[model samples]
Target chain A: MSTFVGLYNYWIVIVLMMAGLYTVIAKGNLVKKVIGLNLFQTSVILFYVGMGKVEGGTAPILVHGDGAEEVVYSNPLPHVLMLTAIVVGIATTAVALALVVRLNEAYDSIEEDEILEQDPTT
Target chain B: MIAENLPVLPIVLPILAAPLCVILHRPRLAWPLAVAVAWATFGVCCALLARVLADGTISYQLGNWAPPFGIEFRVDSLNAWLMPLVSGVGALVLTYAPRSLAAEVARSRHGLLYGVYLLSMTGLLGMTVTGDAFNVFVFLEISSLSTYALVSMGPDRRSLMAGFRYLIMGAIGGTFFLIGVGLLYMKTGTLNMADLAERLPAVKDSRTVLAGLGFLATGLSLKIALFPLHLWLPSAYTFAPSAVTAFLAATATKVSVYIVLRFFFTIAGVGESLGNGAVREAIMLLALVGIFVASLVACFQQEVKRALAYSSVAQIGYILVGVTMLTVDGMTGALVHVFNHALMKGGLFMVLGCVVARVGGSRLSDLRGIGRRMPLTAIAFVIGGLGMIGVPATVGFVSKWYLVLGALEAGLWHVAAMMLVSSLLAVVYVWRVVEVMYFQEPEDAPEIDEAKTDEAPFGMLLPTLVMIGATIWFGLDTDLTVDVARRTAAMLLGGGS
Candidate 1:
């Protein structure tokens, strides 16, 4: 029970990852699939943020002075990396949505099955 | 100063030019700018490869920020070989693109297309140069997103569907890679690849590391389009503008293969805690299956581009099989194929592009009597086909020679036999196109003009022939590609880190 509680953040991560994966695989609507991908990416972001948190740690602001005591601060690198990842995620979403919009204009529908029915080769 | 900045130049030049292209606002201006920058990047790559060959590995800190803390651009013989191939292919295809894009993409959007093409090339080159794990994901998305846009620029609605599918799958692959990098960082507290390599061994036994490896392998396999994960590739190749197809077929998947080599052999040092034999055996099994299945599938494709796209999947299998051997000769074979496959496949796609430009379609039926109508282009296709079949005196034969030698060195007789048989499968598909082009009469091919010779324009033909010429040149002169590949294989197996 202690171990379960201790790893609760990880458990949430796994659950979210699975839900996202399932939605991506099962959803036929292209927009819903993009949302699924967002969920999938959000889980990874959560994982990074969770891993960066230290017990009672503060932000990684450097202190200066003769009396400045050593403070336990959370690792900032993962957070910084995920910030780039968030931007990448947004870019990916934008490209995907733009592609979706074009696909809809061409096919008159965003349903994969409907689009494929219209052009079997696709 | 220029020599010192070699490691970053190939990546920096193109990315800097990408925005300049859009700002230029006219393709007449943008196209020339793109070509000049691409050639400059290739020249820089050649110089970098020469330096790496002479001085050993060169590492540059981005903004002079020392690594483990700042991003590093590291170049060894491995990436030195790849950088030239990527930039060289970009140069060739960009030189050939204006006419091709003029036909396929809209006139008003040509400037934007050139911008996106440069961004895609930048992303691939950046992925090749970076020594940081997270940086790989960043560059991968940059390339993948631009690639989706480029594919959608194809004339038909199918291209739109193809591009959308690729975006979805490629995003998933990129995210998986990000998750893998995050896992590694959680355990090691560093993103620098070399630093991660050094620290990984201490935590080698951890479940986190194993999970990271799993994620990395799966994600890279998707990106590389290795066998089962390759569903996005065929249509993506089939429907993209001819120039985009040629550029991507030659470079994109090969870069992913190089990354796999980096992660498994360099960072993880697969001979250690990675269960080398088990992992190698699994890859070997899949590669063998992929070679047989994809080759057979290629034999049935009606569209010439689709046939070659399936053949690309089979060729990737050949590269992976060589990688699994884990011998110097085997890795050498894989590296050589990485170079050789680009020449042959890029040349073949250019040949198809020529046919598409002239005939307006690449279906087998459309190619009837093409040998008579466009003798030079048809003959180029035949030569490219011969290379695919691993015929002697061609680049494909050279790579396969090293591959078979490697398999035999590893005492994998059956794997070597399967490889030989798959080359015969290539003959079937190539023959199908050859027969249609040469033997069948052009009376049925309404698109083929019977009045005068319709060879591809001098600009397109020159690049296509140059690529085909390199195929034969590299095949005969084993001194360059083979020597570099041998040293690279030695370095990789000697723990390249």
Candidate 2:
């Protein structure tokens, strides 16, 4: 199944993962970092969805007429796990963004380096 | 019903306690509720550990559905040890949190803070006990979110920044971990860890398996803050409220380390093309680097909490070093160090919190004179610091002894030398504090106003002293920790490759 579509999907997920990681590491702004974090989490969702797909295969749920025979279907476990992961990812993003907002309110800046530059005694 | 309910009790108790804490609304009620929940979790963990120690393995199916289809909680040697460390420390830390929170956090937010703390506790405990790989990610987020809230409760405004930094890193780590789990599910068609373990060997040589392993290791390493990846840790510890710093330093990274151990030695088989010598060697190298670099950095930090924070990074290195040795002795050393470091660092952070309560800060300069005025708290700090340096008759030495023996058995003299050098470095840093406290004269003459303040309040002092006692007690009695570590190591490596 190393067709163009399959390979392209894989490439897109990898690119998204790398981009998200780069933002997290390279960005100095706390808000940007959280945004990057959300991107990173969404990349995982892409990966799970990619994994759950099959070549022309339907969902795992049985139809009325196809009952007696074993039907080839895309894997359902990744989809299930990904659903839970999506919920977790959203929770993490909400909390992280909330933290960033709090940080902005507290420090008067969302930039990490600026916050670090402020003396503790001040 | 209670007998059958034993396995999930550790998680359930704390989980139920969190919402109850929020609903109580009264600040006074929050502390007791949180403490009671933590104690209940500790008791359940103790029972579960006892059961696991008696029986080989116990799998509790949720809603009576079997695994590979339903979520399951598996209790074995590895988690049996971790369960107690997380829940027991949760209880101890909660004992100190009320007074500390009152001092550093806003009065209006106290109830919500306590609720979040309990939620984080539940999440950490759940992470250890759950057998589902995906469930690990779910619980990890649960803990991480609450931890961000708890850390941000610090009086210093910059604490919000620290929490944000931790949140970014933690979310990235969790995402990477979820991606890894997804990849594994694609290859194996299951989410249960046991089933995945069984199915993985067949696809061991596949690119998908390797990719999954790479993602999982990288993710867990970030979570555990392995060396270069530890940028978020020191500030998080330093600026966080004293109670939050102590609890997170004790439990958060230790649980992550447990996850690393579980994945590396258990889920990812430990030999041949999969586990391979290269991966172990790489981990060992990074761990050794972490030991020297973090400890040396600790030596230069002026803030007491930041120093201990750097030391925590080095301590993690020691545990990773033990794991990399890949022998029963090595793994046991790593396992034991997890508990020992938690007690030592937890106590040290608590002492710093007490100092913060008294002096309004934990800077080295601030501590110069107060040591004379607060003898009990200073003594507790010294004991805990000595344990950090692996002083004889402390739990730290036991862990180092096993680590050294493991390295020797592996014929790695240089690695053994590195551990010794790191311990010496630990001595230097600990001695820095000791010398400042005892040798140097107070920066200001003790006035009557300051002289009468003997020590921190009982709430803070009790937890610190109890942990100090544990450091000494565990140092003398190695049977329980060692036996469990041996069994866990055997279980992992035996079933691994």
Candidate 3:
């Protein structure tokens, strides 16, 4: 395989990662920043799941009491860990959204720059 | 029976108790429940630490599954020493929190607040003891998410901004860490730290492995609030409820430092490239820059809490610089600084809580003549401040002495000189508070009345005094802090203490 084809997935991961990072940094809306954070985490989950895949690998389970032939199974460890990661991502997103709701109640605006303008200490 | 599960009890106790705090739900019941669980966690941690000291390292595999296959908790001297500091502070803060939170937080919110606090404590303890790499990330998120919620509980609307910023930065940092761990797994196909240690060396030269290490360092640096990555700290600390501030300032970033130390020394054991000063030098350079820059920034902050928040970054710089020295004394210095900084900073922030509770403001201008009004709290703040400046009789001095000695031993005189200069900068910022609180006339603001301003409540005063007393006692008697620090440092530099 050519280098570009071989490393294409990682390149996609980088693009998605950078896009998420940029949205977080560049956007001023609090909810949008959270969306950016979710995007960033989603890319990471993809990277881990992608890394664990094996060519021609089937589900990581064994056939019992049958004509069981040689079967290649994808590494399941990353998949299990990513399940935890996705849960963490969900928890973070939930918390971030709750904070944004609280922010809106207090400030009457969810825009980051507007809030900073109102909060002189910032 | 649970003694066999000693390695996991500190974590399990808090995780188990946190949900109970929520289910108990009545504010009065929840406060006591949280406080009880926090003290219980400390008791369990002390037992775990004692066991580790007697037997060396304790490894408990989950569900009777063996290593490299199931999750395990392995505690040695390094984390055993840290466990009590985290949980002990949790206990004190919770004891201190009820009265303090009564004044600051709404009556209705107490139940949910304590519940989150307990879970946050569990996360810190779990991350410290876990032998699995992915387990650390999960616990990290557990702590960070809860902390974001806790900080948002502040009275001011701006606290939500602080919470939002922290969530964004923290989420990015967590993802980076996950990516790094994924890369490591690709290289070695293992997630257990001890297993990784044995398997990593063969692929140490691989680009993927190197990139993984780099990402891990970067991600941890952000979480630990190292120099340029520290933008989220000042506001978060400044705006969080006083009790939450005291709890987090004492433990959160310190746990992140423990994780970084673990990854660098334990999992990537004895590699030439890692042991060499290549990455260490860069970290050293950043640490030096952080010391001066953060300290300088701290001197000019208008709010006492914000100033101290910046000071926290500078203090972490001192600890990181010691680690980069790659010597026994340096590691010892870092370990000692971890304990000392927690004690001093926790005390300092608790004092702020007392001041803000009575005085109605914490800005430097509003704090005039506080030294006269609240004598005990003021005195505690002074001792804590002196400790921050590395005053001769305080705990900070002992840690700084070892750090400078390590630098000199390493033949890095310039770094040693910089360390002294940065400490002088600490004195300037600390003195700003001392001068404001002591010498100036009590500002004529409505909040400041000469006789009306009384001491903080007895409950708040007690924990603050305990932290202050420990700072002085630990500084004078160096037996406990220094002895454990030496053992921990030896473990980091060599295989085992």
Candidate 4:
């Protein structure tokens, strides 16, 4: 039961990760790919956050009411790391959207197969 | 006091300069500012390499926090060698940009291009020096983001599509890498590389650790454009502005190769990573296929720049072949090839920039009378092509020689033979350009006009020639690169003091 509980979240992470990867590889629409990329990144973010959680632990903040009070806090490092990763994910999504916008303008189509069919050069 | 700060300066200076370029957005002023700052970064790299030589490894803890608790910037022989090569290329490419970019990129976009270029440079330098796992992903994304922007800035509309493709592939690569790092952190509870290295061995047998390693390899291989994953490279390189192509070709994938080595040998421990026969043999087989397939694709290219782009993939194969041998000499060859291929390809691409600047296209027919038109640029192209072919007295020869010696060291004769065969194939492709440029008559040249005898302006020609000169000069005396590479290879294989 403990093993099942411990492994369940990771199983979800893998499923979500694979779903994102499959979307990216399977979808023909550029915008869909961007969304897929976001999903992929979000799955990793979840993995990091899930790993940082400590059961029955309080927030990662020290109480100053009593200097001698025993404290139990979940690890805060993964949360800090995810903050940066979230920013990166946002930056990547922004850039991908911007590129898609430009690509749509230039090619008059955002569909990969149509664009290739319309193109001349390999 | 000044020398103590060299480690941090290279990363910080360009980042500071990047925004300054944006605020001071006059194309004329921004470019010179970018060039000056890049040269200063190169100077810092030189000082850093010297310090690493004098003192074994230079480590700086950010905010004076201790390692395992704080981010550290560590400079060992491996990074010491990469530092000068990457920064030197940045300085030279920035110098070459003003002329090479004027024709291909819009005049309005020059300031923004330089700004993105500096950001990319800062990211590359930061990625090289950081001793933390998470920091690598940050810097990788920074560089990848800026590189996509720089590539999209090309005048051709197709550049947008090319850049979009790269963005998708590169982002997937980055996220995969992030997943891998997160797994490592979960297993070890530390982001510091040295800390991870020390702890990974204890849990090396864990399925999680093995999966993490597998993800790391897959992610980096995608980033490095290794073999089957190389679909995004040729179009991206072919369509980017010449200056961006030169910069990315010289540094980006090479740095990706560095990241792979760092993760496998330094962070994961060599015995746990490369000691796996499956992994070693897989990398070798993929590299061999990449070499022959990319070479075959290169042989049939109609455009010179795209041909060299395919050729870059094959050259990357040479580096990987060296790495897979896992011998001292093989690693040395790979390390030196990192620099040698930079000089050779940078020069080759600059020559292509000049040719394209003159004739408006890099098609084979357009190059027919290019030899007579721009003898200097044409000859530099020839010299670079010879280097690519591993002709003696060129930097390419030095690395290939080391690689072959390494193959023989491991009693791998067929691998050595394959190297020779690919090089001969290199001669065929390079010669295709040569015959058209020098031997074919101008009238026989197709599609483009009979080009006038016009030389590339002095600004661009000078830097390209410097690269060509270094290629030949270093090929003869492998003193600086080979010496550093030998030590670096030893250090990477866990033999360094």
Candidate 5:
């Protein structure tokens, strides 16, 4: 039963990773690429959060008289790390999306190839 | 309070300044504030480096939480050396940005440009000083995102395309790095670098560890723009605003190289049998290819910026070669070159910026006969060009000298020969620019404007000349940089391999 659940979780993560990677590689629009980057980063967060799970575990916070506890606790470190990563990921996406908006305004197009084609120096 | 807070100051000061710059909402105020913040960060880094040098190592736990649990900022001889390089360059670049920003960037957007520049500077410095493995990825993205923004600010439309390409590539690299870090976490159940280094040895031969290493090396190579993977660099540098190009060219990939060194040598445990003779040899071969092919390509470029961009790729090859040698001397060469290349390339690109400001472009043809017009600027360019070509008594020469010696020590005579051949190729590219600027008459020679003949504004020219002077100064008196690099190399090599 546990193996089945674990396998399902892994499958979901694999799909998320593949989806994010595909968008990053295939999308020509700069905004879409940043969205793809966010998606890619999010999948890693999901993977870490998944790994931190302990079946039937309570919060990692230690309570009084909890020595030799009846219930196991989820490892909280990955979740904490993910929180920092999530913040960073958001910052990156924000900055990247901002750049995309500026690029659109500057070049009058968000499409990558259009900008390249219209470049005067090239 | 100061002792407890020192570790986080390098990242926090600039991080806070970014929002402050935005709130101020005026370019004039933002420029001075950013410069002041950058210098403060540089001072903080210097203090941090001095502390690490004196104390051996300093570890700071965020929120007073103990590590393996909380995020850590660990400073040792390795990162202690790098902190100054990143922050010092940040301060120098900001000093030059005020006037250059006025000329190239639109006035309305100036505040935003300086804000992003400050953020990028904060991010790069943070990446170097953070001891948490996952934190490196976070800071990497911080710098990468801002870089795409900064690059897009170039007046030419091509800058948009260049920024776009760089964004795509940088995102892919960042994602790969994330995956690598995730795999390591899955295997070791820890994210702190010191904890991982402690744990990695036990799993040195494990498939998970090997896969993580593979992912990390590929990701970082892309970030460093190593050889064939460097497709986005030339265009990005060529089209980006001159100040932006100079700042990024000087420090960005060098910081990435620092990451590569940290992961491979420190976190991965350099003495692990899994990372043995065969792997080192393969890396060396790739470095050699990068050196020869990139230099040869650089020699034929007509645009001065594009040529320098390719030259940067070749210089990265030299650093990789130093790493591949795996000896103390070799690593020292690589570390010193990291500093030397920053000085020379920063100066060289600033010179190009001056030329761009004066003549309105960076094409080889436009620069013809400008040497007679702008003698000081042209002379500075020549000195920087010669430094790039590794003339004696320049910083570039010191780096190549150590690299050659490193190769010979490893009994790689053929590698040493390749280094010499690549230096000759550098001479070819350097000579192309010199001959154009000095030899050929200006296309419209008769109609000379006296105002244009004067050097760039004192602010712009002063920074360029200072960097040029540093390149020559460090080359002649290598004592300080050499000592720091030697200690850094020893630290990375795990107390003398």
Candidate 6:
């Protein structure tokens, strides 16, 4: 029970990841697939953020001038890395959504089944 | 001073220049700028490779920040060899792109296309040069996102569908890589690959490490389009504009294969879990199956470009087979084929680009009697096809020789037999195209004047001829390609430089 409690955030991440992957695989709607992709990426962000949290820690700041005191701080690097990851997620989502827009214009529908019916060689 | 900055220059030059094309929005100005940047980057890459051969591994600290903290650009024998190939192909494609782009892409969007091309090259070069694990993910997405846009720029509406599918698959693959990197970081608290390699051995037996390895392998295999994960590749390559196909067929997946080698051999050490038993057998089996299945499928394609796209999948199988063997000779074969396949495949796609420009379609019937109509282009295609079939005195034969030797050295006689059978399948596909082009009568042969030869423009034909010439030149003289591959493989398995 203690182990389960300790890894609860990881468990949540796994659940969200599987849900996103399932939606991506099962759904034929392109928009919904994009949403699923975002969900999958967001779960990774959550994993990193959760892993960076410390038991008894504050923001990673150095109190230097006069009141310098030793402080336990959460790791900040993972959060910083997650910021880059977030930007990449947005770029990928943008390209994917743009492709969806063009695909809709070309196929007259965003549904994969409808698009395939229109004689896409793929 | 310039020599000190060579490692980062290949990536930096184009990335900085990419946005300029978008900002200028002048196609004429943009094309020249992109060409100059590509050739300049190629020169830098060549210089860097020479420097590495003479001196050793060069690691450049970004902003003078140390490792395990800030990012670094690392060049060893392996990546130093690859950098030139990426930029060299970029330079040649840019030279061949003008007439081809005008034919397929719209006039207004040429600037945007060149910008994306440079961005893709920058991303591929960044993946080759960077030492940071997170940096690889960043560059992978950069390349992948641009690649989707490039594919979608094709005149065919189906290209949009193909691009969307590639985008979806690529996102999943990249996110998987990110998760793997994150897991590695969680266990070790470092994103530097060298540092990760040093620390990974301590937790090699941990479930976290195993899970990380699993995720990384699956993610990279998706990117490499290995067998079952290759659903996105054939359509993407077939539907993309011919120039984009030529550039990407030469470079993109090869970079992904490089990443697999870097992670498994360099960072992860390929020891207990990765090197033996199920993982090795699974990859080897997939590669062998991929070779036979994709080659057999290639024999049936109606569209010539689609057939070559399937053939690309089969060639990737040969490269992976060499990699999975884990012997120096095997690795040499893999690396050598990476160079050879890029030359032959890039050259063949350029031939198709010429055919599509002249003949207006890439179907088998469309190319009927092309040998008599466009004799020069047809001859180039035949020579490239012969290279693909592993004919003697061609680069393909050189790599295949090394591969069979590697298999025999590993005492895998059946694998050697399987490889030979697959080469025969290559013969069938090449014969199909040859028969269509050379043997069949052109539907409009009599309507046109028989004396006048309708060849592709000199600009496109020259690049195709150069690629074909290099194919023969490198085949006869194994000094440059085989030597570097041998040294790189030796360095990798003897523990990475």
Writing each residue's lDDT as its tens digit, candidate 6 over B250-308 gives: 99999999999898889988674458678897999999999999999999999999999
Order of models, best TM-score first: 6, 1, 3, 4, 2, 5
| Residue B286 accuracy (lDDT) in model 4 | 91
Better of 3 and 5 by DockQ: 3
Q: For residues B1-497, could you state the per-residue lDDT of candidate 5 as single tens digits?
A: 98778989988999899988888879889889998999999899899888888887898988988987778888888878788878887788788887776778788888888888888888898888888888899889889988988898897767877887788788778878877888888888888888888888888789888888888888988899987889889989988889889999989999999898888888887776325888787777887888888888888888899999989998999999998887778888999999999989988999899888878888899898878888988999899888888899999898988888888888888888888878889889999999998889887767777456666888888888998899999999999899989888777776221
- Write the residue-wise lDDT of candidate 4 on B1-497 in tens digits: 66777788989889999998888888898999999999999999998898888878989988799987989999998888798889999899889988888889878888988999999998998899999999999999999999999989976888888898899899999988988898888899899999898888999999989989888899999999999899889988999999899889999999999999899987887789887999898899999999999999999999988999999999999999999898999999999999999999988988888888878878898888788889999999999999999999999999999999999998889999999999988998999999999988777446544555578889999998998898999999888889999988888887212
Q: Report the C-alpha lDDT of model 3 over B1-497, residue by residue, as the tens digit.
A: 88998787888878888888888878889988788878988988999888888988888998889988989889888899899999999899889988788878888888989999999998999899999999999899999989999998986777888888888888888888888899999999999999988888789889999899889888999899998899999999999999999999999999999998888888787444457667778889989999999999999999999999999999999999998898888889999999999999999999999898888768998788888888898899999999999998899999999999999988999999999989899989999999998998774654656676589999999999998899999999998889999988887888422
Q: Taking the tens digit of each residue's C-alpha lDDT, what string does model 2 give over B249-297?
A: 9999999998887776677677733258787788888989998999999
lDDT of 1 by residue, B269-304 (tens): 967633367877998899889999999999999999
Chain A of candidate 1 gets a TM-score of 0.93
What lDDT is reached at residue B360 by model 4? 81
Give candidate 1 misplaced runs (Cα > 4 Å): A64-67, B273-275, B444-451
State the weakest 10-residue window (summed lDDT) of model 4 chain B.
Answer: B444-453
* Model 6: per-residue Cα lDDT at residue A10: 97
Clash pairs of candidate 5? none
lDDT of 6 at B263: 89
lDDT of 5 at A46: 88
Total backbone collisions for each predicted model: 0, 0, 0, 0, 0, 0
Q: Please give the CA lDDT of all the candidate structures.
A: 0.91, 0.84, 0.89, 0.89, 0.85, 0.91
Listed for every candidate in order, the interface RMSD values in angstroms are 0.8, 2.3, 0.8, 1.1, 2.2, 0.7
Cα-based TM-score, every candidate: 0.98, 0.96, 0.97, 0.97, 0.93, 0.98
What is the CAPRI rating of model 5's predicted complex? medium
- Candidate 1, B177: how far from true, in Å? 0.8
Measured with C-alpha atoms, the lDDT of residue B169 in candidate 5 is 85
